[model samples]
Target: MSTEQTSPAPTLAEDDVDLIETTSDASLERTQRRSDAIEREIGEDPTRFRILTGDRPTGNLHLGHYFGSLLNRVRLQDAGVETWVLVADYQVITDRDGVGPIRERVLSLVADYLAVGIDPQRSTIFTHSAVPALNQLMLPFLSVVTDSELRRNPTVKSELEATGDRAMSGLMLTYPVHQAADILFCKANLVPVGKDQLPHLEQARVIARRFDERYGRAGDGSRPVFPRPEALLSNAPNVLGTDGQKMSKSRGNAIELGMDADTTAKLLKRAVTDADRHITYDPVLRPEVSNLVLLTALASGRRPEDVAAEIGDGGAATLKKAAIEAVNDMLAPVRARRAELAADEGYLLDVLRRGNEHANAVAEATLSEVRQAMHMVY
Candidate 1:
């Protein structure tokens, strides 16, 4: 029901006026690059239906997570999508060194999800590993998706170096098929994604079409069994780590979403800053300072320019301290929520189990239709 217009243009708080305009132009060019407005209507349906959004259960969520993708998921769920947040536990191993962290970290990742206000009530929180039949759908879905489609997935190309496994594992090579299962398993109609994930979303839509073409036509067949799940492309930026590198656990630069006060302070104290000392927010000209300022602004719900002004009268040390305080203040209520959840082990488990049950109900509904379409059922 929200009929809000898309904002003027997407820009980082610290983006210069010119850089912001150029970025907008580049976006318009991409839109013109493809001659279709059909794609614009992809995830805009207002039937008040299903959404699937998730994170790789690699590590604890963090500040970067909040402003990056998680915030939008929160918004969507609050806006009444039957939102499902998958704890992609098994997918965490695709590029990782080993499974040692899986057992401990996966649970903690769930805690992070809960702590960050991804309510178990509003959003069903279930693991990728929890649903067996959905994973099984991967092989069959893979049979229909093209090898060219596999290669063209940008995530594949980017992960190639990270995994160091040029010899494609069936698991890594056809991750899109798995993703299609993630969506189609629940008859999901909406998927929130960053720009990097558009190809996979396209493949999901294509796979759904191909399945219908191949299996949906019979003596009485006239309709596709699956709906084309649409992408809710994220408007959030790729949040930088404290070191101004990509915010990742492997990089050892990410500020975790569930850090204790002392640890959070220690991390920010060591965070990178500019040498010139004057406090301003210009990401292109001053990445380090701008990142800190933006983080502070995002966490405090202040505009970047306001943060710039707040720091303008002060020295670099004062700015850093204020930014740190702002971030800490933001983390306070979230941390409190987490602590309350963590203390009540039974309540947390009940939430997870209840959510899993509901999710299974959804999955089973879709699986039944899939079975009927494939003629595997009476």
Candidate 2:
């Protein structure tokens, strides 16, 4: 989901507004763009690298997932570079409390990934719960990172104060450390993430670098063992919930995958729009209407501004009709593909097992190096 949607709404609670932290211009634009020369090089030789990224299976994915990361996942996988989709199942317990739904949610999430065109054969998709050794790496990895670093992470801070309770549970604070295990376990050379996730990735980089510096230097004084992995950033698409809030399951504002057309239409009917009752492209003035335009543009492969212009003076009603048509049209094919795949749970299981095996081979090799370096080898 886009950070824009998942962020705390403008109306803040007393606990949420604690101290009102801010960002400087330099940090604001960090990783917003990469050096053009490096981008060109990656495009010219994309297959020379591997990508690692994933989601915590807290809830079913939503429209925010589609425009932000799901679409990117499909595009990246189609590009022929090695990609891995991880289900951070344990991370689910960090902030959310709905353990009852987890088993169903994880299975549903597996279905959603398949439904959304994450080719199991092309991209490695596995659950964290199934991997014991990878989780074992977390205890050692935790030793290298300091507490201040954990407390200062912007994402962690945002997550902590998002609700009134201020959830800084050990699991929540140590999330980045767990995330480091997720990426480093795969021996991944690149992590595709949004700007908000850069801090978490920074922690991973720190751990990888620290481990190598302290342990990877051989008796002969060779270079560090870890890859010194780099972040391969992609522009995450902006999306909002029907209420013009950030799309999130917690806020009850998300449009989900696997929704039938009837349900989608009902939700879109209640979607927020401009007060002037006119459909226009001025996102600067009309975020609600513009969000609808964005939804259509993403679904139909047209520019959002162009979609607004096409609706002209007909107002939001016209735009809604057009948007619904475009969205349902897109959903029809995805639903059809998903139905076909749903007939075989056995196939999905095999795919995940194979992916785990491939992932485990790489992770085990890296962990072996780590153990040997730290003199922990059996």
Candidate 3:
């Protein structure tokens, strides 16, 4: 299911005409070198880094989440890097109206994390709204960046475009700054993000640098307040949905992490595949079939070409069955654990409570330092 693909050109504002250029091969080489170095560094001394990565409680997480970033989070946590997973509850409304069953969603998200081996004991799982100090950092953070910088942010621009026709909120525009607060609050030095999110990380770096330049001096010695976090770019595969489009809960093409075996099989039955009797892993020629093959490979920890060759002449039915079996088998334990955790709502809430308390303590310390650095401690 592998194919040669070019990175999508970032959707930039009209003013960012120069920034719209495609990624050069040399730039990619440098990124790859940096990624390799980071991996080695993490291996040598995992304690030297703290990672902050999270999701908005938009809906139930799906396989796209599992393979994309969740697994990486688990790996980093297991490797002993200090991990902080924030449930971006407040950011959910940055674009949408009304919080819809937010409490349930947040709890469910925690359950998902726990089910997938994100040890609550090791990783702090907190919510955005509960950490007031973290959000408060956004005030000073915003002061460092300008309106044009926010508007030019690629992630914000893409989100705005997604909201199509809806008037952008002030919160939505300052989303990147809020993200910076999320990272810097805990002083997380590493952030797991995809290439598309590089711009947002860059904005966070800019804010950190500007804030330090403006307010990071107390005496003759310079004391930088915030660390400019680097992006630990993900190497996860681009997993498409059942319909051959991007896997999304909104599109109803996602296989949710909470779905039982029967439900997952039923959904896979509807997966779009070509009428060709022969099965082959030609992503460029047969994207839909190749997507299914990739899913099965990812699920079973096998290679896509091997999965494709195994079902060479069996056609779509065999492919779908293999995918169903592989996915269901992999998720069986996760589903079981999720259901068990879901039954104990109090436990989930307690996890959030503890995480929030810890996050607040850390944020308050950071904010206090920020104030002291800016000579606002009086």
Which prediction has the highest lDDT against the true structure? 3
Model 3 local distance difference test score: 0.87
Q: What is candidate 1's CA lDDT for residue 373?
A: 66
Candidate 1 TM-score versus the reference:
0.84
Give per-residue CA lDDT, model 1, range 1-378, as digits (tens). Answer: 232222232232322331223235575455334313323332464345678878786677887888887777776666666788887877766655566767567567677778776878678888777777777777667767656557656777677766574566667777778888988888887777665566667678777866776555323567677788765656686568878888887788877777887788777778888777678889899888888888888878888878988788576677668777988898888888887777776776677688778777777776777666666674
Candidate 2 Cα RMSD (Å): 8.6
- Residue 172 lDDT (model 3): 91
RMSD of each candidate relative to the true structure: 9.6, 8.6, 8.0
lDDT of 2 by residue, 47-131 (tens): 8767787887778788898888888788767876678889888888887664567766766777788888889888988888788
Candidate 2, 173: how far from true, in Å?
Answer: 1.5
Misplaced by over 4 Å in model 1 are: 1-47, 162-166, 217-220
Candidate 1 clashing pairs, residues 3+ apart or interchain? 62-257
**Candidate with more favorable, higher lDDT: 2 or 3:** 3
State model 1's lDDT. 0.71
Q: What's the distance in Å from true for residue 18, model 1?
A: 33
Model 2 scores what on Cα lDDT?
A: 0.74
The better candidate by TM-score, 1 or 2, is 2
Which 10 consecutive positions of candidate 3 have the poorest summed lDDT?
1-10
